[model samples]
Target: MKNYFIVVEGLDGSGKTTAINTITKILNNNGIKDIILTREPGGTPIAEKLRKLIKYNIKGDEITNKTELLMLYAARVQLIEKVIKPALEKGKWVIGDRHDLSSQAYQSGGRNINQKLITYLSNMVIGKFKPTLTLYLDLPPKIGLKRILSRRKIDRIEKEQLSFFVRTRARYLEIASTDSSIITIDANQNLKQVQHEIYKILNQWLKIYK
Candidate 1:
């Protein structure tokens, strides 16, 4: 079977990590053994360093919008060129916790960067490559933030105002609406229900792809 790159996308607290784990287990049980799980902005060593800067902003220096956008692509390209593409070339399936759509939502919507710029950067960095499947867990920003706050310290991006997330979420929905490969799942439901939906989707996909 051809290798598949699956991505799980959601707000900070929408349980994407959990969903990735469940999806991994589902694939393993279904006989897909050659798999790698990775997250954006930190999959490789250099990218991990960039992740710290982007996520924590430990320097406390205000990062400009353009700088932030460039840093994100820097980390992403490193991950893709060094890790994701290589693994795919080796016929290993990859499950990503987040992917390119994130920049569209966070950078373009949250930071109000122009979509054209984002698209241009994306073309330069990744060209026509895209995930085989993307699962977007959709939830209200307030609830998502509350969930995030309950778990751990908020990161720099997570510290943004509610309105920022609202705009981000709106962009995610808008993008998902136009993309057939992107699957939107209601993340407001109970944990088990969300997982069930994901499993169902994966199972159907497997029937066709595997």
Candidate 2:
């Protein structure tokens, strides 16, 4: 079987975890068991450290938009070089919680950074390497924020104004529309419905690989 790299993307509370879990179960049921789960700005030690810095203001210093974007690419390069590529080379299917798309949405859209610079960095750092499939859970920013707030303390990025996420979601949809690899899911539905959609979409996608 050919190894596949899958990425789950969404706002803070768009049910990416549930989608990942459902996808993993679907793959396992299909007799595909050599799978590795990871997340970005994470998945490696250095990346995890960068993840912390990116997600939280541990220090009093304010992270500039360009700096944040560069840090994300740095962490991403580390993850791809140290973890994702190695797993793929070993024939392990990798399911990621988030990936480059997050940088495009969050840093480029939310932070109002120049998209050209982001694209250039993307090309320079990871080149053409990307996920085989990306599941983007789409939902309203208010709804996502409400759901996340009820669950736990919000992170630095999560604490951004509602307008920020609005822009982020806009960018997500814009990019998803253009990218055939990205499949958008309506996450405003109930959990069961969302999972059903995810299962249905993933199951169909798996048929191609099989």
Candidate 3:
């Protein structure tokens, strides 16, 4: 079986965890059992430290947008080199909770960073590397925030104003519209409905790969 690098992209509380779990089970049921699950800014010891700083202000210091962006790329490079690439080389299907698209949406879109810098850093760090299939869970920022707020204490990025996520979603949609590898799923629907859509899409996608 061909190894695949699959990524799940979405806002906070957009059901990415559930989506990843469902995808894992589906893959297992289909005999694709050699799979590895990982998340952005994590999956490695050094990267995990960066994930903490990225998700929380440990020293209560303001993390500049540029600083945050650089840290994200640092963690991403570590993950790709140490975890994702090696797993794929070993014929393991890698399922990621988030990836580069998150930076495009959250940093470039939400933080208003220049896209050129992002493109430059992307080329510099991991040129031409991307997921084979990206499942983007689309939903309104308000709804997503509501869901997360009701469940647990929000993180640093999650504490951003509503406008930030609005721009982030817009960027997500904008990119997904033109990227053939990305499949957008409406997360506003009920759980059953959302899972049904994922199932249908994944089944069809698997056929193509086969």
All candidates: TM-score: 0.98, 0.98, 0.98
Span of 10 residues, lowest total lDDT, candidate 2: 57-66
| TM-score-best of 2 and 3 | 3
Give the per-residue lDDT of model 3 (tens digit) for 135-188: 999999999999998999999999999999999999999999999999999999
Q: Which candidate number has the best TM-score?
A: 3
Worst 10 residues of 1 by lDDT: 55-64
What TM-score would candidate 1 get against the native?
0.98
* Tens digit per residue, CA lDDT, model 2, 15-98: 988898999999999999999999887888998899899889667798888888888899999999999999999989999999
lDDT of 1 by residue, 44-137 (tens): 9999999998988757588888998999999999999999999999999999988899999999989999999999999999999899999999
What's the C-alpha lDDT at position 58 in model 2?
Answer: 60
lDDT of each: 0.93, 0.92, 0.95
Please give me the total number of clashing residue pairs in predicted model 2: 0
Candidate closest to the true structure, highest lDDT: 3
Ranking by lDDT: 3, 1, 2
Error of 3 at 160 (Å): 0.6
